[model samples]
Target: MKTKVNEISIKYQGNFKISQAPKISSSVNAAELLYNTWNKDQIGLQETFKVVLLNNANKVKGIFEVSTGGITGTLVDLRILFAVILKSLSCSVILAHYVK
Candidate 1:
């Protein structure tokens, strides 16, 4: 006889309303939005790699920071980045690099 293995469970939790989704219409708008998000944390002293996940309609879904490194640069793991995007059900992404 063989024992059964437990299955993993996954869930996405958020209270965001679709009607309130913020849209990115221009590069300047994207940059400004990302700047505001990054500024909330102590991320200005180093280089950081972030992904702004978007929906099929190009509305904001979420922002995820992939990595942080020294003053000059940072590295990002594509696997982790894709995992987050997939988990969030995001249809698009904007790559942002921050340097201080």
Candidate 2:
């Protein structure tokens, strides 16, 4: 008899074309993108850690929020973080955190 096992797969889907994705040339550009995408209301209310996934050309692949915590601090599990980066096939990453 054969036993059934769980199957797992990783997938990434982006609505926008990769060519249209904004490229990150400098810290300022990355900051601007992060600021614009961040939730306005929660900007000053809590602490959150986010990862900016980038392609080989330094173009943004997507942003992933790793965790959101209390006003003082947030936790970032390396396993989960690496998992996201790996699954998304990101060549580089810029990490950002919001503090209040």
What would the TM-scores of all predictions be?
Answer: 0.78, 0.88
lDDT of 1 by residue, 3-67 (tens): 99975433445788866878988999899899888855667678989998889988987788899
**Model 1 residue 89 lDDT?**
85
Q: 1-100 in candidate 2: lDDT tens per residue?
A: 9999975445556688899999999999999999998899999998989999999999998899999998889999999999889888889999999896
Q: What is candidate 2's local distance difference test score?
A: 0.91
Best by lDDT: 2
Output the lDDT of residue 38, model 1: 82
Q: Count clashes in each candidate, considering only residues at least 3 apart in sequence or on different chains.
A: 0, 0
State candidate 1's TM-score. Answer: 0.78
lDDT of 1 at 44: 66
